[model samples]
Target: MSFGLEVMVRSALSHIGDLIAVSLGISLSLNNLLTFYADRPRAILAAHKKFMLARVAELSLLAAFALLYQQYDSLYINTIIDTAAAQFDAGVPLHWQAQVAACLIALAALIKCAQLPFHGWLIQVVESPTPVSSLLHAGVINLGGYLLLLFTPVVAQSSIAIWLLLLVAGLSTLASALIMTTRISVKVRLAWSTCAQMGLMLLEFALGLYELVLLHLLAHSFYKAYSFLNSGNAVNDAIRLRLSSAAKTSFQQAQTSNTVVPNAQTWLMAFSISLAVVIAIRSLFGFDGAFSAWWLFALALTVLIVQWRTCEHSPSIIYTIIMGGFLCVIYAALKQAMHYVLPSYSTLTVQAFSLADIWAMILFSLLFVLSAFLHYQVRWRAVRRLSIALFAGLYLDEWLTRLVLKFWPVTLPARTKQQHHAKSTHQPSLKP
Candidate 1:
C-alpha cells in the first residue's frame, strides 16, 4: 500500500553525475553485445531488436510529454508537477491527454524492465557473453525504476497510470517468480529472476515504498553481477556436493529434499515470530509516521522468519532475534541515507493511496502466501499441473514470441553444410 509522509527533509539532491552514469550505463548495456557479433550474431541481433522496441517506446513517451508541456504554461518538470498537483487539489480532473501520457510512460517503463510480453528478449539474452549479462542485469535493467522515480511527481497524479503500472508489474513479478523455479538452466533461471526482480521493484515504487525500491535496486544489482560472473562455478559446486553426499551413501542418486514446504508447526512459529517482531517495531518506532507501509514490512518480516525457521542448521533463538534487530536497524539507517542521496520530488498526497494501492498489496500478499502454500504442497496433483503451466511460462511468452516473430521475422540465412564447404574450399582469388 502507498504511504503519506511529511517531508522532514526537502533537499533536491539531483546531480549531473547520477544522470551521466545512468545514461552511460544504459547505453553500454544496450550495446554490450557489439564485440560478440562474430560469436553470437543471432543473439546480438535479437537483443538489439528488443532494445530498439524499448527505445521506440521511450522516445514516443518523451515526444508525448514534450508536446504536452508545450501546451502547458511551464516547461520545468517540477513546476509542471506543482501546477498539476494544485489543479488536482482544486478538484480539476486530470485531462485525458495527461492520463494517456502517464500511461505511455508506464508502458515504456514496462518494456524497458522486461515485463510480461516484453520479456521474451531477456530470456534469449543467455546467448550473449557473461560480461554483457552482468552489465545488463546490474545496470541497464535498473533504469526502469529510475524512470519511475524520476517522473513520480507528475505520474502520481494519474490514477489510471498508477493502476496500470501496478497491475502489469505485479503480474510480471508473480509469473516470472513461478516460472523461474521450473527452469533448469542456470542462466535462464537467472534471467527469469531478473525479470521478476525488476517487476517487484516497479511494484514497490507503485506502492510508494520508494526507500525499499531504492534499496532493492542497489542490492539486486550487486547480487546479480556476482551471480552471473560466478554462474559457471555454481554447477561444479552443485555436482561436487552431490558427489560427496553419494560417496557417504548408496551409489543410486538420492532424492532431492522435499522439505521446502514448512510443516504446520514451522508455519505457526514463523508467523508468531513475524507478528511479534512487527508489534515490537511498531511499539518502538510508531510506524515511522507512515502506517501505510506496514503491510510490506510485515511481509518482509514473515519471509525472514520463515527463512530462520527453515534453516538446515538450527540457529540460536537469541542469535535470530539479534540478527533481525540488526537488519531492522540497518534498513532504517540505509533508508534514511537514501532519502538524503536520492531525495524524492513529490509530496505525499492522499491520492497516492488509491484503490490500486490496496489491490496491489492484496495481490502481492496473496502471491507470497500462495507461494508458501504451493512450495509445501509440491506433491499435490493440482500443484504439479500448475508447475507445468509455469514451466511453459504460462504460455504468455510463447504466444508473444510467435506474434513477435510473425511481425518481425528473423531473415538472416543460416550457414548450411554446402555454404560452409564452399566458403572453406572456394575462397576468393587473391588480389594482385
Candidate 2:
C-alpha cells in the first residue's frame, strides 16, 4: 500500500501512476474485507461487492485511456493536457474519443468517491480497525478527486462530462452533508462527512477550481486522520457539550422571557457583512470568482449566526465580525498558496460567470436556507419527515444493497450459541 501510494504521488502525470493508484485502491478494499471477515462477514462481503463494482468502472476508465493513447499516440497526462488546452484555446471542441474517455473517468471517480448509492461501503468499513478507517478516509478515498484533477484539461473540454460530475457530485454533497447530522456515531458521522467532502471536492474540480480542490484534499486528509485517531475521546466530549448546552439553555430561559430568534433583517445584515468581508479579502488577494466565493462565505456566516442565536451568550457582534474577516483572509491566503504551487493547467483562470457557477451558487443558497429552517423549525411536521428521510439516507443505499446481495450472495458461517445470545440480548438500534 505504501509503495503504491508513493509511486502515485511521484508519478501522478504518467500511466504507471494511474495504474498503481487504482491497484492500491483495490488492495485496500480487499484488505478491509479480509481483515474483519471473521467478525463481520456480511458487512465485509457487501463492502467487497461494492469495491468489485467500482473496479469494473475503473477498468473501463483505463480502457478509455488506452483508446485515447491510440488516437493521440501518448499516454503522458501532460501531453493530453497540452493537446486539450490547445484545442480549447483554438475554439475546437474535444474529439469524440476524448469526450468518451472523460465521461468514463467521471463515472469511475463518482463510484470510487462513494457518491450516493455506492456510499454504503464507506460507512460499512468503519467496522474495520480505527487505523485502517483513518487511512482509507484520509488517504485513499481522495484519490478520486486526484484522478479528476490529473485530467482536468480533458474534462474541461467535454461539457457532457463536466455536467455529469457536477450534477452527481452536487446532489451527493447536499445529501451527504445533511445526512451526516442525523447520524449519532462519531465514526459513522465522519464516514458520511467524508462522502460529503469528497462530493464537494469533485464539484470544485467540475467547476475548474483545481487549486481549491488541492487545498481541500490536503486539509481534509489531516482533519479526518486526526478525528479518527482522537475519536475515543468523542464520548467524553459529547457529554461535556450536552452539559454545557443544558446549562446555557437554563440560563437563557431565566434571563429572557422569549427566545431572540434572528429575523430576516438580522440574516440580511449577516449576509451583507459576510459578502463585504469576502469581497475585500478576494480583492486584496487579487482573486477571481469573487461571486462564487461570496456564496460560500455567506453560507458559513449564516450558519455561525444561527449557532450564536442558539447560544444567546456567544461572543459579541464585534468579535464575530472580526473572526469572520480573519477566517476569510486565511481562506484567501491558503487558496493563493495553492494557486502558486499547483501546475499551470490546474490553476487556470475560470470565467467570471457561467451556467454551472450560477447553478452552484443557487444550490449553496438553498442549502443555507434549508439548514436554517431545519435548525429553527424542528417542530414542523414536514421538517420531522424530512429529518427522518435524511437519517435513512432516503433508502438509497438499501436498494443497492438488496440488489447486490440478490445477485451475489455470500455464505455466512454458522452462528455459535454465544453469538446468538449476544445478538438477541443486544440488538443494535438506530439513533437519530
Candidate 3:
C-alpha cells in the first residue's frame, strides 16, 4: 500500500508512474484474494476476474496514451497537460486518438472504482477481515479518482468521454445511495456508501471539478477508514440513540404521521437561508461554479430542520441559521484551500456555462429532489415498491454474478476432516 502511494506521488512527473501505481494496486488486490481464498473461494475468484479486467483496461489506456502522444518524451505529464490546454484554448476539437485514450482512461478507472455492474465484488469481499475491507475502501478504491485527476487535461477535452463518465457514474451514485438505505448490516451499508461516494467522485471529475474531487477524496478516505474500524460499536450506538428521548419522539412521529413530507414553506425557508449563506461565503472566498455545493448544503440543512420539526424539538431560529451558515463556510474554506494548493493548470476553470454545465445542474437538482422524496415518502405505495427494488440493488449485481460464474466457474474448496468432525460434534443428536 505504501509503495502504491509513493508511486502515485511520482505520477505527476511521468505517465509511467500511473501505470506502475495501477500495477501495484492490482498486486495488492491479488494479495487480498489470498486471504479470502479459504472462506470465500467464489468471492476470491470473482474479485480476481474483475481485477484482471481492470489490468487489461489499464494496458489499453497505456496503448491509447502512446498513440495519442506518438513519442516517449511527449508522454510526460507536463507535456500532455500543455498540449491539451493549448488545444482547449485554441478551441480545437480533440483528435480521435485522444478521445479514445480519454474513454479508455475513464473505463479503467470506473472498473477499479467498482462502479455499478462492476461493484458486486466490492460487496462480496466484505466476508474478509475488517482491516482488509478498510484498506480496500479507504485506499484502493480511490486510485480511480487519482487516475482521472492525473489525466484531467485529456479528459476535459473529450466531450464523449465526459458524457460517458457522467451517465455511468451518475447512475451509480444515485443507485448506490438509495441501495445503502435498504441495507441493515453496518459493513454492507458502508460498502454501498463507498460505491456511492466513488460514483460521486467520478461525477465530479466528469463535471471538471478537480479541486473539489481532491477534497472529497481526502475527506472520504479518512471517514471510511474510521467508520470501518469503528463499526463494531455501531449497533450499540444505534441502540443508545434509539433509547434517547429525541430519537424515540422522532420514531413515534414517523410511525404515526400519515404525511411526513415537510411543508413547501419550510423548504422555501431552508433554500433561502442556504442560498444566502452560500452566496455570502462565495463572495468572501471568490469561488465560482459552486451551484452543486449550494444544493448539497441546502439538502443537509433541510433534512436537519425536518428532523427537528418531526421531533417537536426545533432549535431557536438564530441557532439554526448560525449552524447552517457555519457549515457552508467550512465547505467554502476547504474548497478554496484545495484550489490554492493544486497547480492552476490541474483545475479546470470555467468562464461560462456550457451545455454540459446545464445538464449537470439538472442532474444534481433531480438527485436532490429524489433524495428528499425517498426519505419522506416511504409510506407511499410507489416508494415502498421502489425501496424493495433498491434493497435488491435492482438486481444489477445478480446478472454480473451469473455471467462471471457461468464463463469462469470456480468450485468451493472441500472441507477438511477436522472441519467435518467439528460440524458433526456441534450437530444435535438424532435421538433428540
Cα deviation of 323, candidate 2, in Å: 1.9
Whole-model lDDT values for every prediction: 0.68, 0.75, 0.74
Q: After superposition, how far is residue 91 of candidate 1 from its true place, in Å?
A: 7.2
Instruction: Please tell me which model should have the higher lDDT, number 2 or number 3.
Output: 2
Strongest candidate by lDDT: 2
lDDT by residue for model 1 over 1-432, one digit each (tens)? 122221211123133234335554555557656336434545755565575666666575666476456645544445555566677667677777777777777787888889997888788777777878888888888877776776665566677777777889988988898789889988889999999999888877776667777788989999999999989998889778667965546334234444656677866775666556656765665334333345566667767777777776757777766676666666566666666545453354323336756666676677677676566777888888988888888887667656667777765446655556767898642210
- Which candidate, 1 or 2, would have the higher lDDT against the true structure? 2
Off by more than 4 A, model 2? 1-13, 16-30, 33-37, 239-260, 346-350, 423-432
Who is ahead in TM-score, 1 or 2? Answer: 2
RMSD of every prediction: 6.5, 4.4, 4.7
Kindly list the per-residue Cα lDDT of model 2 for residues 257-327, writing each as its tens digit.
64556777777777777787877777788766525545777679767765664574777778778988988
lDDT at position 156, candidate 3: 73
* Candidate 3 displacement at residue 67 in angstroms: 2.1
The alpha-carbon lDDT assigned to residue 116 of candidate 1 equals 91
What's the number of clashes in each of the models?
0, 0, 0
The reply for model 3, stretches above 4 Å from the true place, is 1-18, 21-25, 28-34, 71-75, 90-92, 238-261, 345-347, 350-353, 415-432
